[model samples]
Target: EDLIAIINQYGGAIPETYGVPVEEIQKGIKSGVRKVNIDTDNRLAITAAIREAAVKDPKNFDPRHFLKPSIKYMKQVCLDRYQQFGTAGQASTIKQIPLDEFAAKYASGELTAVAKKAVTA
Candidate 1:
């Protein structure tokens, strides 16, 4: 999954050698990616926003006013990405998986035990 995220972040246009591979990150979004990390984008957006703000108002002393638009823009970008990634309707699917059940299975190292056992047996 970490590799997938790294690939999604920097893997520029799919190579012809791969013969038209499906974008796994996009597929993951469709299945479910509850916590999508946007550190780089967030940092870049905020930095750009701050630089612009500072340039426009060199002596801007009010932190709240200076950063308000930046925060709003960052949030809007995050929302747009979430929608584009097909995660907008994830809540419904997420609700189907009970948290307790998921946690228990996860803790027991049996999240996919049944399938594994069936295959190995």
Candidate 2:
């Protein structure tokens, strides 16, 4: 649907008016959702950037010309998403458990209950 701004494909294109609201996604993140899939948003940003670059210099046949801005726009979207989800800089807080240590913990039956609880919750 997003690509409708440029081209209409086989299934026909609709307006780019459908999406999960950012506030709703943020609410889910706050309510203990461990992960959020936001691939479409990122793709839209990248596509927009590419389209802008292509339109600005229609004869620019080099792929790099399109890719540079695409990377920048996608990076900004990722950063904004991270901030919105309150996950920015949270990677440093993650404790790295080694594979052997994790295996031992699981073998000792320590992780099974936690895994089951997570699944059922």
Candidate 3:
């Protein structure tokens, strides 16, 4: 496949490889590619949504009328990507402490040392 050939040639340093189909995205993920950017597809979806919304409601001059559909379309695309990445049901597995508790610990200087090491590393 073209994707495999490119990965073989460039290893992990390829730049700006966008417009990959959904099946190729899975293949890339399986091939140890950690980051996948989908900004272009999301942008296209949002643009189409806004244009459709504007045409459907020609009387509405409010930006929210267009933005609502755009946001909805973008969110759906993101949710689809999450599912494709096999990470959709991971919310319950993430250990997230309360923001107030985290802030208290941070203010008490508990995370200062950890923060410095993290930043330096």
lDDT of 1: 0.57
Model number with the top TM-score: 2
For model 3, what is the alpha-carbon lDDT of residue 22?
85
For model 3, residues 37-85, the per-residue Cα lDDT tens digits are 9787677556666666766778999999989987987888889889998
- The candidates, ranked best first by TM-score, are 2, 3, 1
Ordered list by lDDT, greatest first: 2, 3, 1
Which pairs clash (backbone N, Cα, C closer than 3 Å) in model 1? none
Model 1 lDDT-worst window of ten = 12-21
lDDT of 1 by residue, 10-95 (tens): 43232222222226656655554335566666655565566556666788878875588669667866786677666666776755
User: Candidate 1, TM-score vs. the true structure?
Assistant: 0.50
TM-score of each: 0.50, 0.68, 0.60
Preferred candidate (TM-score higher): 1 or 3: 3
Question: What is candidate 2's CA lDDT for residue 19?
Answer: 78
In model 3, the Cα lDDT at residue 118 comes to 22
Model 2 per-residue lDDT tens digits across residues 2-115: 444642232334465677888998776666667798788777767777777777789999999999988987788889889888889989899999999999999998887442
